[model samples]
Target: MELYVRLNDSTDKDYAFQLPENATVNSHIKAIFSTSAARIKQRVALSDLMVIRPSIFHEYEPVEYYKSTHPGHLTEGGCLIFDYKADRKEYLEKLDYEKPLIDQLWPGQLIVPQWRMSKKYVAIYVAIMAAWLYTDLPDCISPTPGICITNQLSRMLIPILEKWGVQADLVNKLREEITPNYNSVAAQWAFFGLHVLKVLFTTFFFYIAMANPFSFNPIKMYKIRNVAITQKNEKIQALLKYLGWIGARRATYDDYQTNYYDYIIKKFGGVVQAYRAGAIKRAAAPGVPLGAGEGFQTPLEERFTGNTFKRIDEENPKFILSEEYFCELENNLKELLDEADGNIGRMNAEIRRFRRYGIYEPSEKLKHVVDVRKEIYIKDKEIAEAGKTADKKRD
Candidate 1:
């Protein structure tokens, strides 16, 4: 088979090869470097060689890894490129990149909610609320509908009681007696049930897909593929785009420093490639690689997460803390203080009234006033801390 190779170092140059029909990509790579050493010189390391078949679409072709194990993947008269790599050994032992990094899952099944604040969930909640409101059918303001429902039920039962030769007046009196006793109780339960239903709806709205809940591979095979703790990839976004949320879903963490090696291998092509070019380090400390260097570890977190923790706030410190945020905090603090003062005033007046009647053993209302004061104190301290933090930012 005749093949043309373009060197990474010399992109303008082309090298031709007449290799055996049974030749694999790994064998061809070695043959290129071995035979072309005279012409190519010591341009790249023996440990650093990769053969890539360029895609016409300007995207990476999955055919590179395939060419090694599947001979037909690189056919006769193929145009290929040679690039510097961190590993040759792994190239000979290729991974199957063709098996997708993720699988498609529908929302037919559900798992616990992991992500939140989506408008989709909000809309679903609204619809559920509407249905609940219609079915539960309030008769009064935030009503139990208990008395009204029981009255309508009793009206039908009263006629039956008349047929059974029960006194109508006695029956009406009995109905009136029980309804008064249980009316408030029924209202409280209705309110309680509303709260319970709200929690259930929230839980349901937040549920994730049942299988591969976090965008994991459906077939968990470790036989051929290497173990990896990969970061969230773009495959989910791509899947969502193609499937339009209806077709695909994501059920989308960390281990020791050594745990990231295979992920790096999977990502950048190999271990040496990762250490030299990717985020992995043979470190003396966490991020500090041993050139006898000092400082924290090279950030594995930042490498995958792109420095998400420490966000860049490019606002003026004084304007944000001393003016804007301070105002908001002050308003909240003032509101709590005012509420506490009002409660104290009302409780003191009631105490005065009780004392006038000579019934002054200190009631639950007085105790409640003290609790409100304590709550106010806590809120004040919390608000003060926000102010203090704002001051630190300004300073």
Candidate 2:
């Protein structure tokens, strides 16, 4: 089973497998170290440490039996937790299995504008239409003037709609609905003419409102197209400073992406100690007697060296199994996963979910992850191939 492992202070997310029944801890560790020597070396001093665990059914037993000798074997992170609970067979097989908190949560994106359209902007649009309706005069009864006003308002609205990147056909239908009056050819012409004028007026004012140092008279600026170099340079510098501040953060040694597996192992002790005492079995005489087993034969001659795995028991105080901490952590992770899943699902559902709705443009962070995975995949494939070649040579 694939388990997501996050290392401390590292952007590198990795997946580790839960050893199947056929696989022994010895075989798994050896395989992992052999294939990923550099990565394993960075995280663990494999020669010293041993990783250990008991059967799933016997998880509650105290004093974990190690498969190898070691002080501790490094995990993906400084601390390790299973991210996907449903994938856990023991938990999933139960009829009462509640989905992990992580499964229900969503992760949000780092985006400049969280909203596609602002509420304030929408309110302004509505207010403008409402205010116009309220100002309709009592004496102006003719359909011609009404149609002219409606068409003019529509012409103004349509262009603004286009500028804000909305569908124009909808705006046109809205325009027709708002007018709801038809008259003579003269009225239609008046309406058309007035709409053209309103469109020009709205466009002009809109530009004025948005533009800095508004060029109310663009005709004059159009004639003098040659802009000053110093002015341009100043603008460029301002832009650079703006962007730099936005991107800048104080860097620290701790902030550097780390292999957490390496960090945990290093911090705990040397690799040999972790593995040898923690996991590995040294050959011992089967007849050797311990005080407790004086009357009976020892179940196994070899003892586990490393004590990596722990069982939840009464003496342990059940702190790790506490609902509050586990639930919180599980929920947080689930939220992140769910958010990613939701975004991808939404994008697929609505072809235009992201800017301009084109397929294959993922976030830069996602692209970085993809690149890292490719590198890891290539490295792993090479290691496997080399192992095969070495076995052949020995044969």
Candidate 3:
């Protein structure tokens, strides 16, 4: 039987196996781990398979290793992480108690309150007011009076007020307060302070109005959040694919990773490709020369002597190869090519879809190159129907 494995890490590293009658998913994992290079201290049964991690168990718990193991931190390879183990029956019972609507209220999903928005706006406004207090007075008035000083000051003040949207009417209002004969330093400071207050109050009022819950519609913000979560859900689906849990439908990671394009492409895609290539070569052609450049001798020399093909005949020279054997191999190759093409077609379709609506804007594109492999998931109902139809035909 073949079991397809996908990882929460979004890797699809599946393999076919000749299992004992009672082999379990846990046992299959252990068998794989025993031969792997990963330094796994514990088996974290994430969903259905044991995986490597040294410390953290559940999402509720903080990933303590992050502080020490952060790439920029003091540590080299980072701290170890662990997976949580669940008593299956108990865990299932607990999950059953959760309400449907309750499940929907994930963190970062809720609409932030209007009061919080208003408070933030007010805090920033206050900080700006504090800065304005330190800046020099607008030079509309004179500490010492002269024609040259007044004209120089007027030139500077006019541009500043115009840029700030303070009109000539506002200047006239200020000018009328001063005596035509003389201007004092105190009066200039008072005018500057009044202008600062006017700007602050006007801006704050605009912010408060925009942030009020009644006036502010959450629909746009909610759509952004919804899109984010939808992308997360796609990642979860891809992870299921990586762990080898077959889905109701078959689509390439390119089809799903449009949501979490970076993680899927950089993190998961490489892992899945390595696993698939390793598994296929290991199981299918353990002793076969992969290719001419793969450290094997010249193909011409290998064909007659030191080659997998030659060795097979040496082990059983009495067996004779006929037309039937070559025909079968040819058919198998054709089937493989057909499957490869199908996989490419699906991926191309997904790419086109994403190009039209892919929102990985302001980020790098995901590199999820498509490839084909034997799909092991067939619907049980479909299988049963086919079996019954075959039996009827035989009868």
Candidate 4:
């Protein structure tokens, strides 16, 4: 059998070899070394050999490499991609995944323009991220977060960015933004005012960066983290995504599968309340609830607390056999879950505030939210203070 074994390296060269059709993967490794000693000067052990289908990128998921062979896994006359574990370990150490996608791509998979990864350009992106993160630092330092002006005056600045090699996503935002309260006369004025200021500042900075690139460059001025930062920062959006109600697949909190999990949890108050009542307990054995005469008797006693597993005592996962019980539990669960609805309504103002004003802190914006009470604390305090003032006036 002849197989084209391609090395996923900068060379992008494929090693061709002829061997028995039934040869094992170990033999293939030896063949690769024997075929080309020029490239792989070091011996690649069978344990270290990684084999995959032809891939354009590593996250094309080289993670899904074939370690063991079964029928239909590898085929005769097919091209196979291979990399040594040691070489890949060194290769991976040099990549900064937090950087933009193009910067992080493998050298063999994508060729990046040297200017794009240049110190000046990378620093500009880094500053954009930092400014977008710590938005409370001062407006004079960073562009206002969500105020993208779609007016013709702002449209002119978009080209300045495009000319200076700014990313497409940031540039497009200038053309497409709609101020939230366009219906309100005051909001419209305020929106345009910020838009004008942002446009002037952005256009001048970019033009200077283009003209006197060496002088305007941030890289020359300061020592920064090695990782290249990305723009319009996704952290704020991700925080919203985690807490949003109409659940889509949540990329932010992946452990729970989806944002629906957040809805399920927060709707029920907190962790303890979420699973305590009507959780459809899997019947302790799916589709098989303990019979009336089986497992334990009716009117079971409460079990011990604080332990991860219960040793003894009884709590029925479901009614032994009663529609009445399920109906009652469902009604109760609905009432129990509805308590958090007020929490949802109260968050609307603050969440809306966050979108318009940007976040005060990077950590604050991205912090994982367990309950809704945290953000609405300001409203709670205001109500309490009003109550106190009313009491004083009565006295």
Candidate maximizing lDDT: 1
Clashing pairs in 4: none
Q: Candidate 2: worst 10 consecutive residues by lDDT? A: 106-115
Tens digits of per-residue lDDT for model 2, 1-395: 11121111111222223333333323332333222334333322221121111111111112211111111111111112221221222222111113321222111100010012234544664577445543332214433344335456776787788789787678767665555344455664565556556555654654333322212247745533453434455543343232221211111112221322243346448667645654211111001111221111112221122111121222321111122323333444444445666787663433322111111222333333323333444566799999999999999
TM-score of each: 0.19, 0.18, 0.17, 0.16
What overall lDDT, based on C-alpha atoms, would model 2 receive against the true structure?
Answer: 0.31
Q: What is the C-alpha lDDT profile of model 3 across 1-395, one tens digit per residue?
A: 22222222121221222333343433333333232323222232222223222111112111111001011100001100110211122211111112231221111011110011334545665676555543334445434333333345665676688778897897765454333334466665675678678666766655433222211237744543453323456654443343333232212333333323333334335646645545323222111111112111122233223332233234321111222322333353344345556788755544333222221211110111001001111244468889999999999
lDDT of each: 0.33, 0.31, 0.31, 0.31
How far residue 247's Cα lies from its native spot in candidate 3, in Å, is: 32
Lowest lDDT sum, 10 consecutive residues, model 4, at 70-79
Go through the candidates in order and give the clash count of each.
7, 47, 16, 0
What C-alpha lDDT does candidate 1 achieve relative to the native structure? 0.33
Sequence-dependent TM-score of model 4: 0.16
Best by TM-score: 1
Q: Locate the minimum summed-lDDT window of 10 residues in model 1.
A: 71-80
Candidate 1 per-residue lDDT, tens place, 283-336, comes to: 211111111000111222233343211221222100101122223333433443
What is candidate 4's lDDT per residue for 1-395, written digit by digit as tens?
Answer: 22222333212233333334344333333333232323334322211222221221112112211111100100010101122221232222232323332222211111111111244544665576444344322223325533332343565777788999998998776555533332355554564466556655754664333222222337633422232223343432332222121211111112212333444456567656766854223111111112222121222122122211121113522212122322332343344345447676644543332222212111211111101222233356689999999999999
Q: Write out the backbone clash pairs for model 1.
A: 213-251, 214-251, 214-252, 215-251, 286-297, 287-297, 287-298
